[model samples]
Target chain A: MSLLVELSNVGRDFDGGRIVAVDGVSLAIEDDETVAIVGRSGSGKSTILNLVCGLDRPTRGEVRFEGRAVNGRAAWAALRASRIGIVFQNFFLLQSLSARENIEVALLGNLGGARQRRVRALELLAHFGLAERATLRPAELSGGERQRLAIARALANRPKLLVADEPTGSLDVQTSQSVMSIIGNAHREFGTAVIVVTHDEDVAALCGRRVEISDGRIRSDNRMTAMPTPAPTLRIR
Target chain B: MTELTLPLRGLISRPLRTLLTVLGIALAVAGFVALTGLTAGVQHSFASGINENGADLVVSQRSAFNLVSSAVPKSLSSGLSAVPNVEAVSGILLNITTADDAANIVMAGWPSDSFLWKDMHLLAGRIPAPGDQWSVILGESIARALDKRVGDTVELQFQPYRIVGIASFSSVLNQNSAIVPLEGLQQLLSREDVFTLYEVRLKRPLDKNDIAVARTRLIAAAQGFEVGDTEQFSSSIRIFDLLRAIAQTISLVVMAMASVAVANTLLMAVNERTFEIGVLAALGWSPRRILRLILIEGVIMSAAGGVIGIILGVLTMEMAAKTNFAAGLIVPYLSGWSIAQALIFVFIAGPLGALYPAWRATRLLPADALRRI
Candidate 1:
């Protein structure tokens, strides 16, 4: 697999000189890579996720998608729209659009036409077990259900890289496990670079590798032992 | 399936709010167009009247020259007719007095056979011939006011004259006059061979120099009748002043009200559709595209309002006009050109109203917006 995201000697400052959001961070991930960032609050795990996803620029160093130095904010913006898809910690689905339409927004800039985008959005929703809730708005969904819709939105661009910022942040333990399964299924099926940022050890254990962060810098980068697989069907009804 | 449908569906999701905003905009545009249209109609009527009266120079006796009441003697007409560049001399007598015993009655008299009444149109009935000495013509306004019709007799002082015609004239000058044969007027006014005003129709339209020459020849012949310069006539200035004052007043109010309405509605829309707009930006739509989308929505709303308002205002005017509201109620005329003017106002006001709100919407940062949404 080829390199898809590389952040070298990256530093970010917040609140002027008072806060260092990310300090001289260097990270690289390859295609078909499944990695998790585990950090506490103020550890800059979200900042690192942002930089990798092209939603942000490093104050002092460079971020590259493939080998091209994604040239500051404008280029970062272009990549963010076309090449990268991000699911925020808050599950930031548009309140007005339905679950299906929220996914469709991500496809609009990439697809051929209206019909194809709706079909594609529907297909993605079905993969997340949300085909029946296609017409439901964000408010109508459960926390786990909303997170699943966010996952569909993130994949709308058919992107090479998927970045999830605290995907299970607001879910109960069982729902978090279900979201982890869904994330794992996507990573294995698509063979895409998947970077999940989380505060939970169990969530990080689901990834192939876990990188721990402390005080805006990396503390450890190591492979995590995989968790035992849960039973099939496993309907929590 | 396409990306573009996302924005459209999102916008249309809140149907009631979207419709209300559109309606607000349309009403602003329509009101703006219709009011201005009324002004345009009035100006056109005034100008058309001035053009039809056939006066290159209106020689009013400077001493007592009220625009509504100007007249000259018969002897001056012959003398003014013989002036060097003069083509024809038409003497007119205007005795403008409201009836003491009745409503707003105004009595005017001139030779029915002459070209004076030639420019006048009979809306109903025939002209009062000199032979029909006791008959008079009804001005359009007078017909409505006196509720008099053709073949009905109307009173002037104690004498009754048959209403031979109902007519419309070009000018604000004598539009409401109750007209009769000149010989009958001489008998009533107790004057012999004496007329009041002279409308100096020239062969070629007189410039300032030509008018001066005509004035000099008139002063040279007539006694105590000062033939004022043509340029000094207050018709154009009065109309212009009244038009400017009214236009300034109405436009200021309409533009301010409409612009504020447009800005308020669009700004609210930007807030309500926050995430949708952010989604558009996140999907490679430019700031310009976002601004354009908002403005297009605004324009559609305002234009719809403009159309409905115009239709409403016109219908109101039609109802008022059925009973003969004055031609220039504001300037005394309500006409077709007024409708066109109102629509043009709608077009202009729509964009102007959308400008600020559209700019504000386009300036939002996608990251910041996403957080809020």
Candidate 2:
């Protein structure tokens, strides 16, 4: 399997080096792998995800994607836009835009025209069982619905890598199961490299691999029994 | 959605604040239009009043501020008429006095035999025969104000004169004046040798060379008097200069207020939307695009205000044009250039007011921007 991302001795500091957020962490994510990062609050799980996704630079080490260094801001932006998709913990949906419009925003530079973007957004909403709620804004939607909308938006551009930070942190246990199932389905169906950062042990159990962090360092890396599921027959329109 | 739609949506989300900002800009724009537009109109009135009479030069006493106080010797008119290229010369005497019940009525005295009298069209009755004593011709507006007609007697400075004719001049400024014979006015005022000013007409088949030569000769011949062509005469009016200064000062104050108001509104908008801006940046919107979004909001506000301001200004100008203040001497003429200037001012003010807010938005770091979320 080819390496999708490699971080070697990565360290990130804040407050003029007064606080170390991520320190001397080395990891590699392989292509088509579903990895979960588990840690306590402020244990640097989110920071590690940011470094790997090129959202932040490591202070004293290197981050490589597809065997090339991710250095310049422009290049990182292009790489993120073309190959990686991000889902925030808080959903980060534009409040003014409807569900369909929020999803279309992700397809802005990737799609050709408004009609094409709208069709793709509707297709994603239908696949996510939110087609009837396409015109509803974030405020009108439930928490689970908003998170699902965020997921749909992240997948709008058909990115190869999905990075979700605490995707089910704010959801109820049942809604969290539904969201994890959707993430698992996306991973298995699209063969997308998935990296989810979370503190929930149950969430970590859903992934095939789990890496636990403590005190800015990886404490353990374990692989659990993966439940093989049938791939989703529905494809992107 | 297009990049510009975000700002539009923001504005729509806060309709009240957007409306107030627009109204503020509207008032500032209206102030600019009213102050400068009316001032320019009055200037236009004075200029057209001087130019319409076909007079090439005006000779007034040295250091004279206006025709009301100018005192050139009446004898100068005859010598001025003899200057080469001079077709005719007329003596005009102006006195500020009460007529009927109105105060500060302009009473002009023109030579009855000169071309000045003939230039004014008689609307009713006939022009007072040359040298007719105690007879006056009322301008159309003065006639309406004094409620006097031909054969009706009007008291001028406690002395009654018969209204022999009702006349109208090409310019509104002149139409506001009541005319009497020059000699009659001098006799009545007890200043026989003094006349307010001299209007010099040049021979036609006239060119720029003839005008220049005539101007030079007239200036040289009138040693104790100031000679000016129509353009210079209009510009020399002290009231016009004062009005222009007043207009300029009001424009500056209003522009400053407008800039502050617009900047404050946009800054508040930026502060309110800090988190959203972060989301946009995280979604791959460039800093330049964020700056453009802010500037476009400011411009939309100013432009809406500008359109409303122009409408309000035009209505105000029309209302002012009907008022009798200064006896209707000030005419509010709305010119095309004034409208264009208002638009230009709003355009410049719009972007200038947004510059700081836009820059501040661009300086927001995406990571820090997410902190608000």
lDDT of 2 by residue, B262-365 (tens): 89999999999998877766665556667888999999999999999888887777687666555546677777887898889889898889989988987775
Provide candidate 1's TM-score on chain A.
0.92
What TM-score does the first chain of candidate 2 have?
Answer: 0.95
lDDT of 1 by residue, A1-237 (tens): 888888898998867768898998998888777889999987999888877865555777888888888764445556766777777777887776789888877765567777888888888888778989999989999999999888778776766778888998899999888877766665655655789999988888888789998988999999766433543432111
Number of the top-ranking candidate, with lDDT as the measure: 2
Across residues B1-373, which tens digit of lDDT does each residue of candidate 1 receive? 4433443554477577666755655555444444555455444443344445576665555444343444466767777778888886666565645532444444656675556677678899988776776788877776767677898888775678888899987554346667788778778777556666666676675588887777787678666665553444443335445655676477557656876776777778788777767666655455666777777766666667667776766664445333433432323344556556655666666677777877876666565566575
Q: Individual DockQ of the candidates?
A: 0.29, 0.40
Q: Which candidate leads the pack in TM-score?
A: 2
Maximum-DockQ candidate:
2
Please identify model 2 stretches exceeding 4 Å from their true place.
Answer: A1-20, A24-31, A50-80, A108-116, A126-131, A173-178, A185-191, A223-234, B54-76, B83-85, B94-107, B126-136, B145-164, B183-197, B203-229, B236-239
iRMSD, per candidate, in listed order: 3.3, 2.0
- The predictions' CA RMSDs to the true structure, in order, are 7.1, 3.9
lDDT of each: 0.69, 0.81
Q: Write the per-residue lDDT of candidate 2 for residues A1-237, one digit (tens) a residue.
A: 799999999998999999998899999998778899999999999989887776666788999998888885556666666778788889999999999999887777778988898999999999888999999999999999999898888777777788899999989998888787777777777777889999998888878899999989999999885624533532333
